[model samples]
Target: MERTFVKDWRGVHKAALALILRCIADHGSPPSPAELQVATAAPSAETVQHMLQEMESRGLIFRDPGSGSILAAYPLSAVPTPHRVRLADGRQVQAMCAVDALGVALVFGQDTHISSRCRHCRADIEVSVVGERIGAYSPASAVVWYTPAAVHCAVAAEGQCPYINFFCSREHVKDWKRDLSAPRGQILPLERALDRARAVFNPMKGLGGGPS
Candidate 1:
């Protein structure tokens, strides 16, 4: 299948985006508009809200319709997911997918420990990412199943995040794929998956507040 990368972020507010991501990494949750206004020194809460709306429009975030609070800020998620990451700073947060879990360390420029389960068998998997390399991981045979979104898919998180997953091994990936009438993606080695994660998230580093 063809690859579909992240959208361009030219018009998105780097500072605000950075600040929001930092808040999520540091606090395990997204900041309120009032909090963001105070942190970014925006003119008012209304301005912060507008900024958030812009971020949403650009596919940088997903928000709750009822409260207008952020549910995800890409890579990091406010709601729990299969992939959980523990930062070097001792705070824990949820990643949107397997690649997002690996990208956490690169995005923050810190070490991270990931705890997740295999997509097929649900067996526990753990990985340690140090600097730009994969330090260690359980079930040495682990691999990533990557399914990029359609070229015209509107939102990254909504379009393909759910399908990008970690399996205990390539054998499990094949087993899972066999059940599908037509499997439509690639099975990536751990290192290559990390590269994809880096490509997706590394640019966000230092954009607003410089990771924590």
Candidate 2:
């Protein structure tokens, strides 16, 4: 999937998107339209809902069909996923994918502990993020599988997030790929994966007033 930097958004849009991410990081769920209206000082709930729809259209977020509650706000997912992230403040949340787990620290400007399983072997993988640097990770050979979604695809959570995953090692990545007969995805080193994540999430810091 294409990464959107903070510079690409309008001020209000940035603040709104930042607020949504902060809400998920702090409360383990996305904010309701009323909450977003109050936090963003949007004119009304209808306006907040419209903004959310715009964000969804831009692929910055995803919402439920019936209730319109946010299902995802980029990297973060309201529902549980394979990648779990524990923030510096002890709050735990789900990430949309492996790279999203790596991006959590940068987005929140806090240390993060990511717990996930290798896609192929189901081996537990633990990664520590201190500031913007990767602290320690198990199985030193751990790698990330980056599968970008098709350009015309709608709803990244369905198209791309499920495919990006952590593998215990390069060999396991190959094993899983061959067994599933999946198309080749980029095999990224942890550091390079972190770099890609930073490009996608780091710029949002300080945009929505620091999480509360």
TM-scores for candidates 1 onward, in order? 0.83, 0.85
Give the per-residue lDDT digits (tens) of candidate 1, residues 79-126.
778788987877787888888889888777788899988888999989
32-86: candidate 2 lDDT, tens digit per residue: 7776777667766777777778888877887878888888876788777878998
Among all candidates shown, the one with the greatest lDDT: 2
**What lDDT does each candidate get?**
0.74, 0.75
What's the distance in Å from true for residue 69, model 1? 1.4
What are the clashing pairs of model 2?
Answer: none
Candidate 1, residue 68: the lDDT equals 85
Best by TM-score: 2
Query: After superposition on all CA atoms, what RMSD does each candidate show versus the true structure?
Result: 6.7, 5.1
Alpha-carbon deviation at 174 in model 2, angstroms: 0.6
Q: Each candidate: how many clashes? A: 0, 0
